[model samples]
Target: ASSSSPKMVKAIRVHELGGPEVLKWEDVDIGEPNEGQIRVRNKAIGLNFIDVYFRKGVYKASSFPFTPGMEAVGVVTAVGPGLTGRQVGDLVAYAGQPMGSYAEEQILPANKVVPVPSSVDPVVAASVLLKGMTAQFLLRRCFKVEPGHTILVHAAAGGVGSLLCQWANVLGATVIGTVSTKEKAAQAKEDGCHHVILYTEEDFVARVNELTSGNGVEVVYDSVGKDTFQGSLECLKLRGYMVSFGQSSGTPDPVPLSALAPKSLFLTRPTLMQYVVTRDELLEAAGEVFANIASGVLKVRVNHTYPLSEAAQAHADIESRKTSGSVVLVP
Candidate 1:
């Protein structure tokens, strides 16, 4: 097809925010790229818990009848006028912004797209773009994990958690992870966690303290919120950093200043959008993620996949906590 060709593409549209049932598989007319935008035929789309937030109305929709995806791997089929340095047929993967990747094809700003290395599979690229880049920013920028630093990661078998465990382990950090079940505990261990705590079976704060010889961890990378927030704070050493990035369980309540006064701890709630605001930052973080994958330092485990039309079932599985590692929607 030519860059100017208009076609009907299968897309998952949300007419009303609710459960997975709200995701309607329908055909949408897609036209040529507008100014500063490029049209891509997506090969695969990444599934994150944040997608559920958008679908369930936890996160407000910018408009009605919107496509709900933020990360995908695809090839540029059309380049809008005035967009330079990007040619048609180039493979690209992108994460963050514009919120319309849940389709066979999508229009995205050229600047937001990052080149996908040929050595990496499109499915893997799609799986990792958002989650891997998130781990990149969390470990590198947020707390700056180093050799011998002990850290605790919640939901260790999750999309971002699995990547964080492996990356931190590679950086020589002593990785301790918390999971809900024994099965997930095994997966977390395989992902380079030095110690896996079954939060369902035991007290994680005690285990984290036990694992570190009562010293506690230098940082706590907590994605499971509410249920684990105070426990996460307890696992931290005095003046330790607590990076609260997501709320899978539920949002935590307001924190009083006195909450941190005991340990004089540092607390941060960071988002991927804030970390990769500029084009350079996006490229830099993405470059490292792709490089690590290419070199085998970062292994992307896409454990689950579904056709684009089955996005609803996929969402249900993720929300139920039945899926682990990364999940992708093949278009």
Candidate 2:
């Protein structure tokens, strides 16, 4: 029993998969890592709306009774085969796949974990990977925007919204963001949004036309799906791109491809994982973000942090559209 003893650790998991109340904090045994895995001693966990999708069953999972955090910054407590850069006590951060980050210790793939720069805070690393990568793909891959391009981004004060604003601004494009109220507009403007549309009061499509002198923007990054999809498409200039990255309001109904013809527009939906399928690719994508942060070209604003046990409350805050910017969970 001594040589084969099990170790116990704390984790947050859900039961019955309903609302926020289902996120139960409990003690569970931590076990040895499998091949090519490492046990991470988490310092911070990145909380995202995707976590809510898992909790709400919008994204199907293999089973229930799960721990839903997607990304974390941690120390490498132990490592198993094929890992060299990470060793005991090495500070590191990882994002994407095998979502069990809401814990004191959990096993994850060696390749999936990336080393955190000593200069950057662990919480920022935890917060940036997923959201930053999403922004990277949206700008670089989804539809490449050039200088002087005008764009509309929704929820522009939220996690990814802030990053997109900074990235677009640095690229010399005019960035327009929409929020539900004036407070978020200020936040978005503070995040580098050139123009902020208060959607609750203004007709955003009309506002987009107003901002562009009736020519419309070159693209619209719409995450507030159902409520804004049609109008988002209408906000584009001739041959503009519509990048629908998330479903904050709800998933919009399918669009007919022919609709793009009226304005000679383009549309595509992109996810981060698809953008970085290989280790070399993932690190390259991350390296751009790391360098941007280090150089001060990009700013990672973590607007909130909650204890891992209080994840349900975090999800509730996100669902309410009240909280702005990134939310992190410290385990």
lDDT of each residue in 1-331, candidate 1, tens digit only: 4555777899999998788999999998878888888999999999999999999887888999999999999999888877889999999999988898999999998999999989999999999999999999999998899999999999999999999999999999999999888889899999999999989889998888788889999999999899999999999899999999999998998899899999999999999999999999999999999999999999998999999899999999998889999999998
Worst 10 residues of 1 by lDDT: 1-10
Q: TM-score of the candidate numbered 2?
A: 0.96
The candidate scoring highest on TM-score is 1
**What are the runs in model 2 whose C-alpha is more than 4 Å off?**
1-5, 81-83
Clashing pairs in 2: none
lDDT of 2: 0.87
User: lDDT by residue for model 2 over 194-255, one digit each (tens)?
Assistant: 99988989898998888899998888898889999999998888988888888988889999
Instruction: Tell me how far the alpha carbon of residue 311 in candidate 2 is from the true structure, in angstroms, after superposition.
Output: 0.7
Best by lDDT: 1
Against the hidden reference, what TM-scores do the models get? 0.97, 0.96
Count of clashes, each model: 0, 0
Name the runs in model 1 displaced over 4 angstroms. Answer: 1-6
lDDT for each candidate structure: 0.93, 0.87
